[model samples]
Target: MNRLKLISALCLLGATSAQAAPSSSGPIGPNIGYGDASNANTIYDPLANPANNALNAADTEGYRVGLGINAQTRIEIQDLEGASDYYDNQIDPLLNDVANAAQLETNLETFIANYDQGNISTISGVTVPLLIKTDSMAGGLSLDYTRQVGAAGIIIKGTGNVTPAADGTNLTINRGSAALGVTYKQLDEFALGYGFKAVTSGNSALTIGVTARYLTLLSNQNNVDLKQFIDDNATGSANFSDYVDGMDTGSSDSNLTADIGINWMADNYMIGLTGMNLTEPTFKVNNMTSTQTKYDYFSSLVPSDYKMKAQYRVSAQVYSENREWTLAGSYDLAESNDLNNNDTQWWSVGASYATNSAWYIPDVRFGLRGNLIGTEKTYTNVGLTLGFLNLDVATTTTDFSGVEDKQKDAGIMASAGVEFDF
Candidate 1:
């Protein structure tokens, strides 16, 4: 009965807080729509889409900008029945053997307090990307902008087994961020980019990132928060009174991480190897308390540090006189400590056809993508280009077991923009 109540509460929370937000790929190509943009559609250039491929083609003298919106809703249900029985032995010896109504209630409350914390986060924003090729430069320059607003709600109802036993715990948080980035390319083979991100909420912090494609390197840095620290230590019933002795002695840490990749391109095929987050940077939050009538409470939570070691991608394209078809696949290395991490792989096949019917539409393209994450999922997208304007839409779904227990995530994402020729 306790399990049923917990599941029901989680479902309610997930449904209420689910919202729509702008996806990462609001500009440029559809290849970056759901997966990595590097593998989307490559015509001659190894890194960019075929529409903007520059290896064997002349640099186009023009600029393009786009705007898009994306929304997602998901439901997750986990069964603790199959989890390890260590909890029964250490926390409650009689938990597993008890069958009485009162014992059942107590055990359920204890389990929920220890592990059942429901989380909901929503991110929405507007993104803009601008690309321009000048007469003097060999390649082009691109500028990116994103302004997003986010909110998160966390609920951890206290259990019947803890010292400060409480019926329910609630926290509502709001956050906002703005980011700007610029990239410069030389002869379409080498590129350099840097970005800045500013976040404001309970605390304010700044993050900076840099990317170098020729050398296959990318790095980023940012600060930490105290609320996150409290959440991390909530599971352990240790006395935090000592940790939060000084409220003015706030704790903060910085993180620095990098990625490396190698690329090889042929006439019709391309392959690449990449490693993300090679630097294992840890962010720690500390809580300190003082000894006097005066009050001070400081707390901190730190995230586990790890690196992504394996990531590879392969892509091939077949071109006709005026049309082309592309196929690609990729695999990502998984994190060990994060339960949400999964060893996921993806495959995509898409085709673009040319048209000259100026009265209706100029071009049409279609694509199909298959993903194997925690479960098997499939996505389909259709795009149209007419003169200076481009538009696209996509949908995805997942299948699992049970009716009420089954899960599905489906949404419509669209982007529209114009290109200017100098």
Candidate 2:
């Protein structure tokens, strides 16, 4: 019931539109990214570098632990409508009916119709340009605790991303809007893992890290074709459950995955290379039998094994004298990773200028983040660090109106965190 899995994710997750904290990636100051090692300390972060891995630019030796909360939400809709309508019509209403399969389909269909219009547009003097890219609307919440003793350290984290895959280049959405008609593929994941990180010594600039996680596959096929249900029984909307008792949407499974990383640093510069789910995780989910509820549609669990793809990233960073000015770049090699296979890969550059000052002045930091090569979105960040607390914010904007007579896509992501060291 893969479709059911999507419904579960959409209904279950409570995270809102926010920034990706990526706590384990270290304090990025005004920089925002998890896969960006060069910008966020990829040299010391295992996931960013994964091969083994750098300089403790902050002299972060001894014992250290950090605790924080992070949330990330990414959504794109046709810039034709007012931003408030997208929320009032899609996000908020769905937030209340997380279990209503029918309602979920209704809202999604509306979203798809609007989005498809943006994908195909013709310039007045040019041939029709087909943008084979999809929009992404994913949200997540995480709680993290990390501790390190000497060069060997451990980090424990729990993660959740709730929302089914909505991005598609040429989605035949109406292709399956019928009740008990088209089956929705399911995909949801939940996990907690302990990561091991360190360099050869306190002063070593080479580092690598690994993490073996207990993964749970909450995604499955979700079959709920309302039109099919109505036609099969030839009955009015009376006693809905009676007509589809056994076809209830609910099914799940679990598995395991690992991450590998490596990185190096020299002078005021750093580089990192890493792989997520390098082994390519998969699930041999139980084949749900299709129970006859409408037409040939059944809510039975269909058995199928799905591949969780792998992702690769490379990053580099440069710092000016006294670490005042910073420039960094990150490239997503897998673009479509197993964890978030639908979201587009982004080639991002983040630059920040931080000034170290006493309590009154605080450390003022500001930077620009954008997909200089991959996608069309651009983000800008501003941050302030007071003692142990850090506050950062960012906004995403895209203008594809050039093809659609001037339509725009816009979004925002923000986060805050604190750290302790001895």
Candidate 3:
């Protein structure tokens, strides 16, 4: 790819786009609408907390099925669009005309120095094509994809020097010193879960549940070289599209993981605890090499082995006597990271109302959620259910001027699905 094309690709890496707070690698649930799921009692619960499958089935008479799709993205930087404009309109052009080396250095330094280094921007989506739940069991399939890009190590201003070729047609920088580190991964899961009443005392029952899933994984870890393409004397010549295709390291692997949970069900209240990724399955992603150039490209660091860390969470709920009104809350007992290694720990609380007697009146749900670790932004959630269809959306309270003077939030999510009971 030509120098300008290469630069353009790099600039789009952190473009002003959607960011998300990924709570689990499961199907979309009521939590996506109400910002909490401890006692929501939905068919898709088994995908998130195995115990929920049987626990929720207890509230129904027969079999249940749910299908859902969810997508979300997050950008925490205050002025990300501005940063892209600075790079595309100013720094990139100066790269080719090395005669203005002094000006190029100044612009590059300013771009790096002003960039947001505090938060890790993320994009994630999950689709649950089908899920089946019975009185004592639940099983389903889910596909999850996540991408995380942190701009921290990409630019080390004082550690390296930028120098242009004597003829001012080419530029050089310390190899491996300036590059964007990006990680993308996807998981396809075939999951099965079972639950049973373990103990009964007074008006409450303690139900235990366990789930195991066969996982198919694909991942890519890329380090984009900023200086390689600018070298006019470089040997390789490829268009921007071809170069991007080559960036995929093409790594795939598989493993088995499991989750366990327990729920104490009572007449008017419920409490639950869930533990996910109990086996701590680990995977590998090929560390992409720098763009092929005549110069040595061995200085780029190899990515570390990535593993799925275990996470624990707790939830509680209270309901009205008629079972029409519900209040729920959920919190993470400890912080964890998603597949892309972004920190995550969330706390959510919300309420919902449904008139089970009427199909014409839509079920209403509202809630709030915030991350305890990364970004730490809070969001307001709203959802509606009409007959067998469901729709949910959530957005952060804070907004920033994005590209073209448009306003955007730090995080947002939308989900839609259908469910039926037989």
Candidate 4:
């Protein structure tokens, strides 16, 4: 089947539907939404870089609680124009013609010759229902989800050349073991972290922190089979409810993991290093048989283990002489797979201006970020702080060369929260 063509159509539809909701934002930090975590303030810093908790305790005494959500979807197509043309002129004309063997063979060949393997798509997000931090520690509850559809697969043709009935009501070829599908994963975790002030020398200090997390895993591997899906739709058995009941879901036992970080804070400068998922916790995907089997024609594609890989990062911040303006940067030391199993390593920079003594005045923040490995798209970030409330947004530039209004690289993220101090 025309896999890239199918993905192209879905991408176009997603762009149109996203207008009603907040779309992709790089990483979920209202204070540094553009991707820099090194110079985060006390409240948000602990979650961004656990070691910041110690520095924060020494600098100020306060506590805060907030909620945030970050989600994004991206589809990259090398020749969207060509793909659209194929989809319009060839694929759509015979989308449900399983009875036509000759036409199906021709279309399959066209898909292979012109596809060229430059298509990829991923949907991923993080939701923080409650995040809190005190002078000495930090803790939170968060949920994460990812959906990845593989564009690579092989088609198995029948052994004998079969001819369809003239009446056009019978099948021409047997639906063989040809397979294609997507992977879905979700995680919910509760985390508690603390940092210790190790040494104080002159106007500089050193601190180290560690966070422990308890995680629950859920997933559906090989959730879709193109052949089965199409047949269901044609036979009028593929409604939304049926689709939901078709999945063979899986869950894993609870697991524990940890993150470690260190920071060096000076009079007007700071730098930090962090390693996340230090233990690389592993989960075995288990089948939780579905209740309804109406559309459960496909079997589980493959059973595999999901492992959280360790990721390392470093950051630095420079403050203005008067302490009103701040500039900061952060970079990932090595590549790691995101929630969607896509490789990613990011480098981010940001600048902010604030008045130390004003609660009514609004603080301004701006930033730029780019992925060093996967997606490799650059984004612009902007944020505002008024009184106890913080708001932020980030997005990538649009591409006009492809289909009109199609968000080929369309991505955006928005977060808002309020805080209080004692």
Choose the strongest candidate by TM-score: 3
Evaluate all candidate structures by whole-model CA lDDT and list the values in order: 0.32, 0.38, 0.57, 0.52
Clashes of each: 15, 42, 7, 2
Ranking by lDDT: 3, 4, 2, 1
Give the Cα RMSD of candidate 1: 13.9
Pairwise lDDT winner, candidates 3 and 4: 3
Please give the lDDT score at residue 182 for candidate 4.
38
Residue 194 lDDT in candidate 2: 30
22, model 2: CA deviation in Å? 9.0
In candidate 4, which residue pairs clash? 24-72, 24-412
- Top candidate by lDDT: 3
Query: By summed lDDT, which 10 consecutive residues of candidate 3 come out lowest?
Result: 148-157
Q: Which stretches of candidate 3 lie over 4 Å from their true place?
A: 1-29, 38-41, 55-81, 88-90, 116-122, 129-158, 166-172, 232-240, 246-249, 291-300, 355-358, 397-409
**Across residues 1-422, which tens digit of lDDT does each residue of candidate 4 receive?**
22223544335333332211101123554544535563343245566666765634223334544444433333333333354566566756655465565675566556535543333334433434344545444322222222222221112222223222222442222232232333445556666666766787986778788777777766554433334544544445453234334232544456888888888877788788988888888777543222235323334434567676778888888886444577888888988765445566778898887543567877788998777876676778888777767677766654544334332544455656654433
Model 2 Cα lDDT, one tens digit per residue, 1-422: 11112222221121211112122212232335332543332111332443322223432232223333222233332233432345355644543343554565556555434432231110000001011101121111112222210000001111221122222211112212322211122333232323223444443356555555444443333334433332322333334233223321456456666666666655577677766665666765433324543322334323366556666777777776344456777777754422212234555566655433233445554555554332355666666656555566666544434322332445344545542221
Kindly report which residue stretches of model 4 are placed more than 4 angstroms away from their true locations once superposed. Answer: 1-26, 31-34, 57-85, 96-104, 112-167, 170-180, 237-241, 244-250, 286-303, 321-324, 399-407
Runs of candidate 1 exceeding 4 Å displacement: 1-29, 32-125, 133-135, 147-269, 272-312, 321-325, 333-347, 353-422
TM-score of 4: 0.74
Tens digits of per-residue lDDT for model 3 on 39-145?
A: 33444555556656553323444455555544444443323335555767777777657577788777766765655232234454444434555544432222233
lDDT of 4 at 265: 75
